[model samples]
Every structure is written in C-alpha cells, then in structure tokens.
Target: MYSRLSFSWTASSWAFALLLVFPIIALVYEGLKPAEEIFQHLMATVMWDYILNTVLLILGVCIASLLVAVPAAWLMAMCELPGRKHLQWALMLPLAMPAYVVAYIYTDLLEYAGPLQGALRDVFGWQNSQDYWFPEIRSLGGAIFVITSVLYPYLYLLARTSFLEQSVSLMQSARLLGKTPTQAFWRISLPLARPAIVVGMSLVAMETLADFATVDFFAVNTLTRAVYDTWLGYGSLQAAAKISVMMLFVVVLILSIERYSRRKQKVFQKALTHEDDSRFVLLGWRKWAASLYCWSLVAVGFILPFAILINYARYYFAASWTAEFFQYSVNSLVIATIVALIATAIAVLVGLYRRLDTRPSTVLPSRLSSMGYAVPGTVLAIGVLIPFGWLDVQINDVMQWLGMKGPGLLFSGTMIALIAGYLVRFSAIAVGAVESSINKVSPSLDMVSRTLGQTPVKMVRRVHIPLIRKGCLAAILLVFIESMKELPAALILRPFNFETLATYVYQFVSDEMLEYGALPAIVIVLVGLVPLIFLNRSLEQAH
Candidate 1:
C-alpha cells in the first residue's frame, strides 16, 4: 500500500520536475537537428576564435579567482588578525555586484576621458594613448579582472567553510611533526580542502563561461557572443542553436569535473568545538598586511565601484529617477517575484520527492532539473525561443481555425518566455537550497508523522516546510537577486516595449552611455545586498 502511494507521489513529482526541465530538452532537441551548412560555415570562419576565447577566459578566471579567494579564505578561516571578522563578510560583498556593472563602472573611471587617466595625463604631462603605458580596460585582461573580482567569492565562500570545518586533531598532528602553522596549512589544511576548492573553481569556470555582457561589452569574441551575434546579428537561429549545443558540451564537461571532485570527499572524525578559540593568531606587520590585502579585494570589487555609482547618482538623480525608471524597477521586481515563487514551489515538490521517494523516477528528474544552471543565459535564451516560438505559431493557427483572431506570439513574445528563461536558469539554486534544508530534518520526523496518520503532503506542510522555512526564504531571495541581475536572457526574452532594470541598463551600456544607467545599476547592486547580508548572517550563525 505504501509502495503504491510512493509511486503516485514519485510520478507526480517527476511530472513537475520535467515541466521545469522541458526548456533544456527543447534547447538540446533544437541544437541536435540538422544545420550542416551553418555548421560548416562556422567551422571555416569564427568558430576557433569563439572556442579559444572561451577557453582562455575560463582558465584565466579560474586561476585568478583561486589566487584571490583561497589565500583570503585561509586568512579569515585560520588566522586571527585584526578586522578579520569584518573582512570575512566584507570579502563576500563582491558577489552582490554583477561583473558587467563593475566592468562599466571601472571602464568609465579608467578610460582616457575618465578621471583616472585624465588625472594621470595631467600629472605626467602625457598627451595621448601613445604617450605612456596604460592597460586598456576594454580588453580580455580587463574582462578577467572585473569577472574575477566579482566571482572569487564563490571560491572564498566554500573554501572558508571547508577550512573552518577541518579537524583540529589533524592540524595538531601536523604541528607534532614539527611543522610550523604555515607548513601545516600548506600540507594538511590545503590538501583536505582540495575537493571544496575544485568545486568552487568549477563554479567560477561555469560563470566565466556563461557571462555575456562583460565579454560583449569589451568586444571579446566568446561562444556566448557568438550565439548572440549568430542569432541577432546574422539572423541565423540554426547557427545560434549549434553554438549553444557546443557550449552545452563544454558545460557538461565542467559539471562532470565538479561532480567527480565533490565525490572525492574526506571524512573527519574530529568535529568543530570552539570557533575563534581554535584559530591561529597573527602579530604586528603580518597582521596589518593580511588585513590590508583582504580589505584591498573588497575595495576594488565593491567599494570603489559602489562609490563611483553613488557619485553618478548624485548628478544624474533627476534624469534617472523618473516614471520610466520606476516602471522598469517594477517590471524587474514583478517578474523576479513571480519567478521566485514558482521556482520555490517547484523546488519544494522536487526536493521532498528526492528526500522521501528514493526511486530512480524521482531522482533523475531532480538531478536533470539542475542542468540548466550550468547553461549560459544566452544559450538558454536560444534554447527557450525555439519551442516557445513554435508553440506560439501553433496556437495562433489553432485560434484562426476556431474562427477567432490570432493573438500573435502569445507565449514567445511575452513575459511567459522571460519567466521560463528565469526558471530554467535559476531553479537549481532553489532546489539545492531546499534539498539541503530537507536533508537536515531527520527521517524519524517523517516516520512519526506517517505513523500518526498523516499523508506525505501533510507531513511536508506541517513538518518539512516549517523546518526548511529559512532555506525556502534563502532560495527565494537568491532567485530574486539572480533574476534581477540577469541581462542576456532578459534581453532576448522580454516582450516588445517591456524593460527590466537589467535590460534598461544594457541599452545605455550598448550606447556607451553606462553613466546614464549608473543609478539603476546601483539599485540592482543595492537590492543584491539583501541576500548578501542574509548570507553573511547565516554564515556567522553557522560558525
């Protein structure tokens, strides 16, 4: 009897999960269809440039993010330096700033006509680009810098947790072997945290791969840009779909590596007892130097960019603070809120199924639902358009047959497509969050509820949902933030005449008028702070 009930629940959960997974399947199906002529054209012309640029960007960002994140994470996790507590959360502030917004802000401040180079020319009596050496902010290296500055937090967040969770006994064993604290960290702590670090690196690699605005703004030709240019520029959706398939293969490889790394887990017998009491202490210049280094990352990543935006807002408030801007903000919040609610509901269904059913039917869909998170926004946008566009055409034809006027593009050319894109892109965050919280609730609780004459649905509502409320809230906030900051998908999927803050910012950015959009950009970052603060507080309480 229980088996029959479980089967029904599993089937229903799979159906819901597959609904979330359909867009990805549509993308793959579209990509797999024949496009031999376009494929040959790409192979002969711009394909290698796209491939090479994407590879180089991922490699550069991975190395740079590790360099920035691992050291700072170690400092905050292991060493007790002045301001260490503040720097720990402060380092995470970058996660709130979108890389493209940072790219625009820094480019504005660093370009020749901007304040930095202008002041430099005045001070050094330099005349032009040829006068003295200045690193171009609109180049590949600048994209790496801006992206790494914002993305390093992915690594830092995981690596620091791994470090803090290290068994104290292991560190003491290293010390007993006559190793210094630094040596112990190098040999013992770092090795123990390798899997976590690699997991973070994989995340950074995925983000670097998915990014479009930073690369597109800098005119760096990547696979993401290739998709955009191929579709919108050359008006070849087939070619764009092909490029997206290639990107999907790349994402598959990266996700495989991440999964393999995560599976190489270490079991520590010793558990955390006291937090600050177990940390290493730093003294004098080393203490100050550590603080300076950590603080510098925050300054460059968030503080400086934020300061520039505030300055721009001061002068541009009248121009930016208008009805149109308010509508854009409303559009952003409305779509994001709807997406968050839907994603969270889907997450709860799938998450509970995975926790209770323990069957292949329930498990596979739950896993496959997350595959979209690795897919680049531009790629997902292409993937989403194919089926939604076809569905719209079919619906229109049916309406005409039924003797009613066709509502053209009822799905593809409206917020429905945009919401679909957001759900496909960010539902994984919600699933992961809710799954984690579900895992923490003991199985005995479910058993108790079942023995007390409760259905699985009632068990979830009365027991699981209340327990995982924090995780559900986190998932909602996270999806909301990501939806607000998302640019490429929103740019492609938004209805005619509709604009979100991200799309609005992209317009001014495309016009090389990012300063005009600076205020809205700042608002996006400010809104992002809600989650960052929540995350930091969560981390603090965990410790």
Candidate 2:
C-alpha cells in the first residue's frame, strides 16, 4: 500500500494541515490573556448594538434570500417563459459581484445626492430631505437589501439544481392526488428542496458574518466590524483576539446547525429515465410574471450595478486612469497568481494523500485541511498574525544573540504573511475541486498500472494527472479569482503601503470617492466573471 516516500508524503501532509490550523490555535491561545477591561468597555458601549445588528442582518438576509431565491429557482428549473433559457444562467451573474461593491454602487445611486432620490424629489416638487420621506440606504435595512440581493444567487444556484433534480414521479403522484401545481410545489417541491435551502442559507450566513466592508461602509456595527475596530481602532490586539474568538464561536454555531440539518436531509432518487413532459406550463399573465420576477433579480443584482460602474468609469476616467491604478491592478494579479499556485499545490498534495492512503493517520489531515474554508478571514488574519508575529520576534532575538544585526519582521512584515493567510483561508476551494476530479478516475486503472510494475507515484503521474487536467485548471482559476476578491485578511496582513485591487477600491469606498475607483472596481467584477462564465457553460453541459 506504500508508495516511494509514502511516509514522507503522509508526514508532510499532516504537518502542512496542522500548520494551517495553528493560526486558529494561536488565536485561542492568545485569548487566554485577560480582556476584561476591554470587554467591560465594549459591553458598556457598542457591544449590545453589535450583537443586535448582526443577528438582525443574518435574519433579514435569510428571509430575503428565501423570498427571492425559491420562486426564481422554481421558475428557472420547472417553468418555461420568455427568456427563461437565458435567465437560467443569468441569475448566477450576481455570484461574480462582491457584496461590498453592490453596496457601494447602490448607496451611491439611492442616497439623497444620487439620481434616484434626486429624481424622486424633482418629480414630487420637493425641496430637500425634510420635504419628503425616503428610505435611507445607509441603515441596517439597506445593508440587508444590498447584501441579500447579490448573495441570494448562492441560494438560487443550489435551489435551482435541487428543483431540477427533484423526483418527477413524486410530483406526478401529488398531482394524481388532486393537488394543483401550486399545491404540489408547496407540499412536495419545497419540502424536498429544504436541505439545499438550508445549505444555501448556511453559505449566506457565513458570508454575512465575514462581511466587513459592506457593514463598515453602512456604519452598521456587527461582530466583524467590532473585531476590526477593536484591533485597528483601539490599538489592542488582545481585545481583537478575544473578539475574533467570539466570532469563531458564531461560525461554530452556524456549522453545527448545518451539520444537524444535513443529517436530517432525505435524498430522493430519480425514478423515471426521461424528463417529465408535464412540467407546470405557464401561459398569459403567469408567464409574464415569471419572466418579470427572474429578470428583475438579474437586473438588480448584476446588470444595474455593473452599468453604473461603467458610467462612473466613463465620467471619471481621468481620476481612475493612472499609473498607480495600473500598478494596483498588477499587484493584485501577481498576489492572486502566487496564492493560487501555492493553494493548488497544497490541495493536490493533500488530495493525493487521501486518495492513495486509506489509514486514519493519512485521512485525518485532509479533513483538517478543509476546515479553514469556514473560518472568517478576519479570524484567520488575527490567527495568522499572533503566531507569525511571535515567530518573527524569536528569529530576531536569535540574530541579536549571535552578534549580528537583526532582520526586521521576516514573515509577518512581508508578503509571506499575506500569502499564508490566503492559503489558510482558500485552499479548501482547490482541495474540493481536485479531489472531485481525482474521485472520477477508476481504481481499476490504478491496479492495472500497478500490475505493470508501476509505483503509486508513477501511476498517479501517468494516469491521474492527464484525466483531471481540466479540473486542475478550473481549481487554479477559482482560487485566483477568490484571492483577487479577498479583502479582510489582505487588509490586515498586507505589507505597509502595499495595495491590491480590493484594498484600493476599498480605500476610495471608505473615503466616499468610489467615482475615482470605479474602473478598478469594474475590473474586479469582470475578473470574477471569468469563472462564473466557465461554470455556467459547464453546468449547461452537465444538464
């Protein structure tokens, strides 16, 4: 069962996975320090508001997501209307947009000085904010709407897939039992899709918790905001670490609910071999309504915001077009490219270990490695800083003891920390992608190669790599896009004066000057579209 250096691979895999988790361990270790003074101060001030806002944000997103996603998913999967074909994939376009980008764009449009409210005031012959009532786009409710609009696509994608895969036979049986199409959907389709909905909500919940820029921009206080403010605002890393620990607890609770829901999920197998021609056919007003619903989501979530960014770029071209902008773009690309390669390599190694070695010793590392994807970037950044900062100090101390000039923060003060934080945060994307491809290969092929006197390493090199080349490319592309868009961790861990496209856009956004940053923000959205378009084509082929 052993390949050449199987021991080496197994040992290294475990070590690497452990290294990924060590940051979280470090956070917990640092939280052991006294934080009572900071905690008491926060409790007396904004802590309760943070808790309330965060909970309300999660609940609001969940409700909005369900309302928006379920009907859209049903329409795309089960009904055929005008442009239903295009809307099926168009609904996923929002998946490429960062929620913070959407927030920035919409707030710019809907706020008092923006076109929407200005037009409203002009149409109503109103003079000022005191002259009329308008919904504020910078409140908790606005944060919910902006984030949910962009993020509901997560729910839509999964819920649509679930709807498509539902048992046609069961739906037919419901119809046979004298139920109308609507009743059958309410009774059978929705219940069957519950697990997918739960999974989607869990994704939304985690993303909501991870959000810093969106909430920060809206001036909403959430736990993620509190962590950033406590650390960067108060000059207290200890308090920051404690708050991060608390945030991790929230993640754990989310994951626990996900696990429990998954355990109760019922899987339904397809009983019929062909498509049921009896799909709920829409006509007249219903068809138009369905079309309106699906198109509205696509427009609000992607098309409108994207168009606004383009307009801003056109109008503010001089402000946004400069050498600094080019360098920021290049810096982002270089970092994402590097992190993607490293994360992909780690993913491949750990994935191969799991495939070739069945022992618990080898398997556990892979499982451990996958856990970091769920941890928030803020928590991951703090976790990274605590340990890496300590290690840098030890190295400098050693240099001083040897009568040599001490090097400054080697790992913590440079790109090393940023890349490390990225890998720890995003490697799971690569691991899952590669492992999926590896699993599709037949074990019999491996056995035949082994019978021909090939070592396991050689057999994998010969057989597995060629088969999963597409999957590997897809993994690299995905991780690259994610790294490009990643912000919180990059914000905390980047070297001073270093700027990625995300951080650059964020700077303008924070200063309320997104006009000058519009082009880069558009570049980010366009870059993210690469993988979404690829995945959309892939899903088409699969269907």
lDDT (Cα, tens digit) per residue for candidate 2, span 205-303: 999899999999999999999988887788677788988888888899988998897895668668552153757778889889889988999999999
For model 1, the superposed segments whose C-alpha errors exceed 4 Å read: 6-11, 173-178, 261-269, 358-360, 400-404
lDDT of 1: 0.87
User: What is the per-residue lDDT of model 1 for residues 105-156, given as tens digits with 9 covering 90 to 100?
Assistant: 8898888798999999999999888999888899999999999999999999
Question: In candidate 1, which residue pairs clash?
Answer: none
TM-score of each: 0.94, 0.96
- Candidate 2: deviation at residue 387, Å? 0.6
TM-score of 1: 0.94
